[model samples]
Target chain A: MLASIVNPLILGISIGSILLISALGLAVIYGAAGVINMAHGEFIMLGAYSTYTLQSTMGMPFLLCIPCAFFIVGIIGFVIERNLICYLYNRPLDTLLATWGVSLVLMQSSRLIFGSDVKYIAMPEFLSTNLELGILNFSTFRLFLIAVALILLFITWFIFYRTRLGIKIRAVTQNKEMAASFGINAAQVYSITFAFGAGLAGAAGAMFGALSIVLPTMGMHYVVEAFLMVVTGGGSILGTVFASTLAGEIQSIFAFIFNDTMARGLLFILIVVLLRFRPQGLLSTGSGRR
Target chain B: MSFTRRKFLNTAALSSLALAAPNLWLPGAQAATSLKADSPIKVGLLFSLTGSLAVPEEDSTLVMQYAIDEINAAGGVKGMPIEPVIVDAKSDFKVYSAKTKEMILRDKVISIFGCYTSASRKAILPTVMQQDNLLFYPTCYEGAECTQNCIGTGPLANQHSFDLIPFMVDNFGPKVFFVGSNYVWPKESNKNAKVWLERSGGELLGEEYIPLGSSEFGPVIEKIRAAKPDFIFSTVVGASDIAFHRQFKQAGLKVDKMPIASLTTGEIETAAMGAEYGAGHFLSAPYFQTIETPTNEKFVDGFLSSPYGKNGYTHYNMEETYLSAYVFKNALEKAIDMHGVTDVTPRKIRDAAAGVKVEADVSPEGLVWIDGDNFNTWLKPKIGQCQADGSFKVIKEAADHVAPDPFSIYPDSGKCTADGLLGLDGKLKVDLI
Candidate 1:
């Protein structure tokens, strides 16, 4: 009984970590720009596809493909932001619709190129093995995911709190006019922030593609959870981390008690209830509206 | 007002000419004579060409085209060319219903062949029945439904589970666990599976359902480990299947120790996962790509060489869809032969569609025919182990074609109970009531 209880808890933590990594990018972009990027998931999809192409065509190592995916998706995101998203800034509704349109185009483009067939990236042999702890056994790939999530969280935190770019981004996010008055180029800051967020999504995608099937529409699967995490976390980096971990643990526990379907249903209900109480979310940064 | 005799005579003559003019305008005799032998019989081809299901359903469309090409090449259906009116459902059920209705009412298609999923079929079923049209649906599904207007050219749950459960018990162990996508097909199929488990003296350890499109299987994997079931029976479909297999393999669960037996895994899934991760998983289906026969070889070669088969992965659903076309063609020819060309209607063709035997050569599978009673096809179920080359190696096959039992009423002892054992409260209580 103890083993059963402990195993699901561990699994839940792992799940939460994955959700955290996937949602971090959305939170960063949405919180900073107040642009609900509907295409964030597609960015992740592009990252996964990039990893697949690199590994298959160029025989690139799986480890190397992670950064490569980030860079590739980051460049794509930068271009999209400059050409499309920049025009719709401050117009949230238009931005949402535009991003959605971009997502559809990306999905169709991928289908045309990849032919709608599912693809998989082979993980390293060592990572494929399970780590059998006393009464708790989990896959190393999941452990790696958790570790990556932690590393990414730290990196994101360091960037925001410790780096110069982080200060510029936060300034622009908090008061764009004030930051511009202070001689900070808010446009460049927004562009860099969007690209960085997309790069994070790309990294998440690389991890996810290894974990699941890579298809044209695979982004939709992760995007929902990512959005939930962002909304529940109140669209902040630290808040998202907390929300995802809580959500993941709750889901696993509920699933363990009931079933997977019921767990998901219950999770949604809980999120709704939480939102009903705290409309601003678990942690409100107030960076969204302005 | 009519005073003169000449005026009255002219009025009578004009009235007679008006009556004669109606007859002259009506093409009653000419219409019959104008029945041209070269006219094409329009058939609606409805399947998802875009969206999530496009990957698998696209192949079904290709197979339909392949069948149409072959039939037309061989002097058409009774020398009248088959004009395919194709439409993409886009993986939406509402769209499926609208398309089916439009094809029947607007295009006046003689018959329609499409729908890969049960949901889409159910959506279009009402329209097909109400419109009194024939729909040839070709995909193995959780069957208890029998509709006269719709002909199922795929195996039912009974045909697959009856053969599959026993085979797993005999070769693997009596202990089993079940996992599937949360849907009607998986839920109903698992219910039947529970019945089969009891009949074979096998014990069901646990059963769980993940939401459709769920990628995470960590908690479920842990649960399976704790239960220590001898084998897993997975009905998880689409992207979820890929996730489950990859996770199962990555978690170092050896197939030899506890292999997975699936109803949904096929050539496409195997290819997607590739041999390294996918091999050793067991699948039970009516058709496999690796079937070695002269006819199958030719069909496979022809399809692969065709432009539509560039992907080089022909799934069981594709073959089933291909077989549906031939079944429709055979029934169409029979209907035309029975009722002369002018007298043929949807009802007449549907009546003739019963027990339509498709020769072994036309289908990759051998000796497929529709059962007149259930409207499901009589299929030979085969157990295949995935090979490294993204193909199935037939480990076992049924001795003969298993008759379709959509209701599973036959072999009354094997009848499924209402309890699907889907409750998540605890492990399944396998004691037979």
Candidate 2:
């Protein structure tokens, strides 16, 4: 009985780590800029495709591809912000529609170029094996994923909390007019912030691409969970972490008691009920937007 | 009646029109007067050219075209070239229904040859039945319904599980776990597998269904680890297949020790998941590209020469799809020969298909014949282990064609006949009971 309880908790953390990695980019973008970026999933897809191209054409190692994917996707994100997103600032609905359209375009573009075959990312031989600690057993690659997620989270926290650019981004996020009056280039900060968020997603993609098959529509699977985590966490980075882990644990426990399908259905119902009771979300601020 | 120059030309045209008018209405016309002697016989190539299911379905479409081209090059079928009216279903069931309608009603295609997933096949079922058109479906599926309008060219439940389970029990231990995507096909497949397991005297460790296209398998993995099944009978389809294999490999599971005996995984998926992930796993299918038969070699060579066969790997689905076109062609030719060219119709061709037998040299898989009883093809079930090159290494094959039994799960359920399903008590039933 104790084994059952402990096992689900550990498995839940593993699941939560995956959810957090995928949702980190969405959380950063939404939390910092208050922009409901629907194209975030496609950005991760692009990161996967970028890694594929670099690995196949340039013969880069898998470890090298992760950073390459980050920079490549970050550049694309910067370009998208400067050209498209900069004009839709403060218009949440318009941003939402535009990003959705962008996502569709990106998906179609990849399909046309890559054709619809599933692509694979080769991982290191050691990472492909399993790791076991007594009753706790799982994939070594999954443990690596958890480690990567934590490192990315730590870097994100450091950038936002310990850096000068973090203050500018937060200041602009809190009050765009006041930040602009204070000589902060709010547009530049938003651009950098969006790029950084996209870069984080790219890093996540490199890991995810190794975990599963890489395809044009792979983003569809992750984007929903990412959106759910961000919404449940109230668009806060730390809150997303806590909410994702909690949700994962609950889901894992439910699955242990029931089955996968039932657990997922119950999880969705619980999320609905939780949102109904706490409309502002788990740890969101109870203040109106400036 | 002034016989001027203009009047003479008008009189001549009227006389020719009157002479040709009877040929249009006469059923006994010696030739196809409705079409020019060189006009092609139009058929619809309906498949998802885009969207989630496009990967394998698109390959099916390409193989269909290649088959049509081959038949057209060899003096065409019954001296009439085959013209394909291609349409993209976009992996949507609604789109499948609409496209089937457009093909039958507007394009006037003789038949449609497509559909990989059972959902799309069911979606277009009503359209084909209502229009009284023929559809050649070439994908393995959970068998229950037997429709004359739609001919199944792939293996059914009996051909796959009946042959696969016994082999697995003999080779591996009898403790099997069932895992599949949450859908009708998977559920029905598992249901059939359960019956097979019982008959084989195997023990069921666990059964789980993961949502389609879902990548998360952490909890499911934990369950499987705990159960310690000797082997897994997997019906997971699409992208999820890749995820399952990759995760299973990463979880330190030994494929040689506990192989995934799959109905869905093929060369395409194995290639996508990488050879390392799929290596040593078992797949049950009717055909594998690595088959060393001279006929398969020629077929593989022909596919490689085609534009879409750049991947250089073909599997059961593509082989079945390739042969379905030939099945249709052979049936049409037989119909034309029997009833004359002008009297050939979809119904006549569908009826003639019951008698059509494709020789082993013609079909890469082997001799194939449509079972007049259930409208499903007789196929040889084969088991192949995944190799390091992402291709199957054939290990076992049935000696001959296995009769398709769509209602194999229910022993006394009735057999499909011309009149309908006929039960054991000499009573006629409308459908499977």
- Model 1: which docking level applies? medium
Clashes of each: 0, 0
- Residue lDDT tens for model 2, B165-246: 8889888989999999999898888888888889999999889999999988877877887788889999999888999999
Supply the DockQ value of model 2.
0.65
lDDT tens per residue, model 1, B1-433: 8569998889889998897674345442221111134698888999998988887888888888988998899988889888899999999998999898778766778788998888888888877766667788888988766565778888888888878898899888999999999888998899888889899999999899988888999878877887888899999999889889989987878889899999989988877776777788899998888899888889888889988787786778988988988888898889888988877777677778778899877778899887765567888999999887768999889998998766563343342222222224443322121
lDDT of 2 at A40: 87
Off by over 4 Å in 2: A1-4, B1-38, B423-433
Candidate 2 CAPRI level: medium
Candidate 1, residues A1-290, lDDT tens digits: the string is: 88888878888899999999889999889988778989988999999999999999999999999989989999999999999999989789999999999999999999989887788887788887887777667788988999999888888889999999899988988889999999999989889889988999999989989988898898988888999999999888888989999999998999888887788999999999999999888998875444
Clashing pairs in 2: none
